[model samples]
Target: MELISSAERNRLFESFKQDAFHLELRDDYSVPDEESPFTSWTRGESVDYSFMESWTQLIRSATSEGKTVRRVRVITEPHTPYIQWEHETTGINDEAGEDIRWLPRHRLPEGITFPMQGNDWWLYDDKLLAVGHFDDEGRVLGSEVITAPDVVAECVRVRDLLWGLAIPHGEYQP
Candidate 1:
């Protein structure tokens, strides 16, 4: 399957008419751009977050146009260092107009199964999906664009369920 670069995937935001939803299923991600910042954070050192400006800008621009951006992160309790950091920093995303929620894995509905073989995905306007693929070391490889109705439908269903169940960023503690 052909994959698109993250930049290309982000471009989808420009054309999508309404909403963009992201489902995050990982406890840790090894994004290259975040390596130094994450290392610094882990070391208890103050670190610059300029690396996140580009993404926040994207969300800001899109949401300013009245488009909705949302995310539901499924995580385990006793968060990993990466997740702890992500939790601490989620306010930035929220401030940019992205509605982010957290759902502990244990709280997932019984018998529910994720589509796209359980990988993370971004759903745009409930019609298109950009499924994230990661290398063995957990670095993102890019995304595979899928417009198949069945797949998108299942994702929409999952999104609806999880979104309803997740706790909004400000309300969740740890």
Candidate 2:
């Protein structure tokens, strides 16, 4: 696959705004060192704060106008509250009719990381944000990436369920 430049990536970012829903895949959703500055930090994780701010504002508008946006995260533990906020703030519907599935990281055969291993992906829709790990199996392992649409559907289903279980930030814990 041909690599796209930062400018092209930015354009992809812009496309997210135009679409009613969007998806993203990242190593982790939150900015690293969120707990404390004292924590060790990664090398050169430059982020787009301004762009993220703009996106937040769009969320505000969307919520006020009652347009739903789904934010999904496929993580091992401590799922972010922003996901709940994103759902409640977006005023998403409870019964969004999406599928849900979970396959553990350990389930992933050993020896996989970002570049060498396939990266996970996120899918956002009017009612859900779905995340899936990407991978290519070694001759002795499972497939590298999720190429099947049925598995994708299951991931979406899982997102819908978790979204329902998640409560609005600070108000109540579901």
Candidate 3:
């Protein structure tokens, strides 16, 4: 409902979840995605680690006021070495150790397909990109959507590259 500013984006990152505020970067700068999946396919803008932490903090804050959080969907090029590098660097993929959740594009229902990938078309869910902002016992609060187009593009493009790398259902890639 409200568009957050760069300053606010920064603050949220520093004082919040280490991965709280993420931004999107695109591989194809010439094309700005009109069908931003923030509305359809995936959730939240990609952010630097600082912003990511702040996002986590904001979710906790909402819960302090009585809310619950359960899921967050991140769209990324499943093949990006950066994905693994970041998780490995930030310790976000520690299984029973950290808070990061990795969902390859193929895992979600109808999440991946052809023509879409070959033409560099990939869609993600914005609804899924949010935290619960729940109650102490896990009830429900509101939602947080990352609407910044730049961040969205970054995420989408990165995921596109990864899609290229991903071993498809029929072992397809073109």
Best by lDDT: 1
Ranking by TM-score: 1, 2, 3
**Model 3, runs deviating above 4 Å:** 1-3, 10-78, 92-98, 111-174
Candidate 2, 1-174: lDDT as tens digits: 333332333233332432232232232334332323112223233432333444455455554555454543333333345333333323223233222222223333365333222333344332222223333321111112333566556555544554554434334332
Off by over 4 Å in 2: 1-52, 61-66, 72-121, 126-148, 172-174
Winner by lDDT between candidate 3 and candidate 2: 2
- Model-by-model lDDT, in order? 0.96, 0.35, 0.34
List where candidate 1 sits over 4 angstroms from the true fold: none
lDDT, model 2, position 106: 35
The Cα error of candidate 3 at residue 21, in Å, is 9.5
Candidate 1 local distance difference test against the native? 0.96
Shift in Å, residue 106, candidate 3: 0.9
Model 2 lowest lDDT segment of ten: 137-146
